[model samples]
Target: MLTLYMEVSLTETQQCCGDVEMLFRRWSVLGLVIPTLLIGACSSTPEKEEISEQPAAELYLESKQRMNTGNYRSAIAHLEALLSRYPFGPHADQVQLDLIYGYYAVSDNAAARAAADRFIRLNPTHKDIDYALYMRGLMSEDEDSNFFQSMFNIDRSDRDPAMVRQAFGDFERLIREYPASKYAPDAARRMIALKNRLARYEVRVAEYYYQREAYVASIGRGKYVVQYMSDTPSVERALELMVESYDKLDMPEAKQDTLAVLKLNYPDNSMVN
Candidate 1:
């Protein structure tokens, strides 16, 4: 093409000087004009085919095959490489989903959480977003979420409340956002377990003070349970302890008030009322 154009241009220039026939003979001898056009046409198709194609389905099948064979790491390797090369690959969602399970199979909680976050961020409106978020919560959940342990750890200077709060909050957020999520029942059940454990811990702490005959301290701790830990199962016991503490302190009016609250709330509780 270049050779022909150059000869044609030269021929046009030459024609203006009355040399037309000689330029055409020169272009024909070099054969540049016909060959270049044919080669250019032949080369175009392969480029277009390459651009308008994908290996996404093949990659997904290979990863799934490896996963089924119990080769999770190999599957991860394939999927991860594909993600970098084809961000909008057809198997993008499946790659992420399998990545989560693969990380779990390899006992890599950090990777599992990362994969879950990536999946959630990329597929915000995905039907499986709730599952991804829930998996993230499970990946990071710690002992502090156990209400029995949380109270003692809450004041632990070495522990970070931010991490614990985030883990629990994710579960709570999932429950609120996807109220009908399959995981919602389990999440709510976990909250109930947490409440029960915390309630028991409060009662145990109050009893410790009571056993030491620190009536005022015992009363304060019981009041703390009633005021702050009201949702816990220990509320009933703490109210009874408050009554006992007030009686020992010879505060008759406070004792009467405690008894009234206990009676009003649990009229069938003969032990306190």
Candidate 2:
């Protein structure tokens, strides 16, 4: 009876050991599989989330809302995404125009100009072409002067005239190409101001030359002002500058002729007196 009990106990112990070994193997496999499964799940979730594409129409609405709420950056994000995803969508052209406005609103002149140029080049016959041209002219005008200078009454015309001339050209083009466009009136008014400013710039340069006793250079700039910007208020000053320059150069005939013109045009002008 004692021998039988010992053998039975050994057999039970061996069975128990086998069961534990099987459980260990199953747990080991599960450990490796569970980690791989977890890793795969984590990796796939981000990709799925990242690629969640919104419809182009939905993006347009979202961008419009952001713009209405004055959230320009978010509006730009939505607009850019829409453009990337739906290049040929119904709202593509409108989105491009809005981008130009948004960039201009944010004071990003370079991007605004680039977007306007692209729009004009791509959609020559678009109904909104006038608007694009108007916006382009406005961008150039802003480039030549900022709010700070306007607020402080600083003279930006005394600085570079490249942007000024560019703006004038754009405004002139807008007026010439789209005479009946709603933006034409404003563009016309702006062109007048720009012309005056350009004339003043020429006079300022002439004055600088005169101050330095460079009579020839001064006379050249004066003549340019009178010839190019004839309708501007600076014409009187330009004539005066020419007269002074001619006097300095000892050219009596030119001085007398310039004074005569100045007196005929601006009879009460103190410069002529």
Candidate 3:
């Protein structure tokens, strides 16, 4: 009788084990497999919403805000986006002008000049052409602008003259085309400074050649200043160098002519004595 009872208990334990295995199979599909399938399906879905274009006014305002807060790089992004979205929008002209200023504010001299040139070409009759021209000159000046350092008498004579010449041309255009422009006065002042810089650059080059005993080359540089840089202070020094250079070259006649001009222009010049 005890053996029979033990056999019955064993049978019941086997049944319980079978039920657990079935339960596990059902739980695996419901709890794991189905959820994974659902996740995969959800993840595979394509984006259904299109990105809308922001209005040009909105973009302009955003750019303006960025500029006002001194976020120049971000402002450039918005200004560029505005142009891309609405090339001929109501604010197109103003946006182009603002773009030039934006490029300038961040010291992007090349881009600023290019934008100014584009604006002038596209909007010749623009009432604000003066402002565009002014900005072009400003950008050019800023490209070569070391005047602040020049205040300490630091020589900038070794710098490239291309930018200075461009600035001079822009200022001259502004003065000739829009003499009444609000920016004309400032442009005029900057032109004077630029001319002096060019003259000084020529004088410095002539002096360099003179020092190196390259008398012919030195005379050429000095003559350039005397001919084109007429009223500048450097012309006097330039004349002196030319005379010295001529003497070195054994051209006494050339030396006498340069000295005569120096005396005529700068009667009290120390070089004349």
Top candidate by lDDT: 2
* TM-score (C-alpha, index-matched) for candidate 2: 0.78
Ten contiguous residues with the weakest lDDT in model 1: 1-10
What is every candidate's alpha-carbon RMSD to the true fold? 26.4, 25.9, 27.1
lDDT of 2 by residue, 6-112 (tens): 10011222222233332333234222433343344232222211223888777888777666655554566777788889999888888898788767655567888
Please give the CA lDDT of all the candidate structures.
0.64, 0.75, 0.74
The reply for model 3, stretches above 4 Å from the true place, is: 1-53, 147-152
Model 3 lDDT tens row, 1-273: 000001001122222222233233323433343335334433233343332478766777777766665555566778788887899887788778878876665556778789989999998999988888888887677667554455576676787789889889989999999999878888899889899999998888888999999999999999898888897889889889998999999998988998999899999988777
Return the TM-score for each candidate structure.
0.56, 0.78, 0.72
Residue 266, candidate 3: how far off, in angstroms? 2.6
Where is model 2 poorest over a 10-residue stretch in terms of lDDT? 1-10
- Can you write out model 1's per-residue Cα lDDT over 1-273, one digit (the tens) per residue? 001000001112221111222223222333335435334433222221122233866666666666665555566677777676787876667678778866655446678788888888878998877777676666555424433334455433224444455556777888999999988888777666544555566677777788888889888878987887787767889998888888888999999999998898888998653
Q: Pick the candidate with the highest TM-score.
A: 2
Cα-based RMSD of candidate 1: 26.4
Per-candidate clashes come to 0, 0, 0
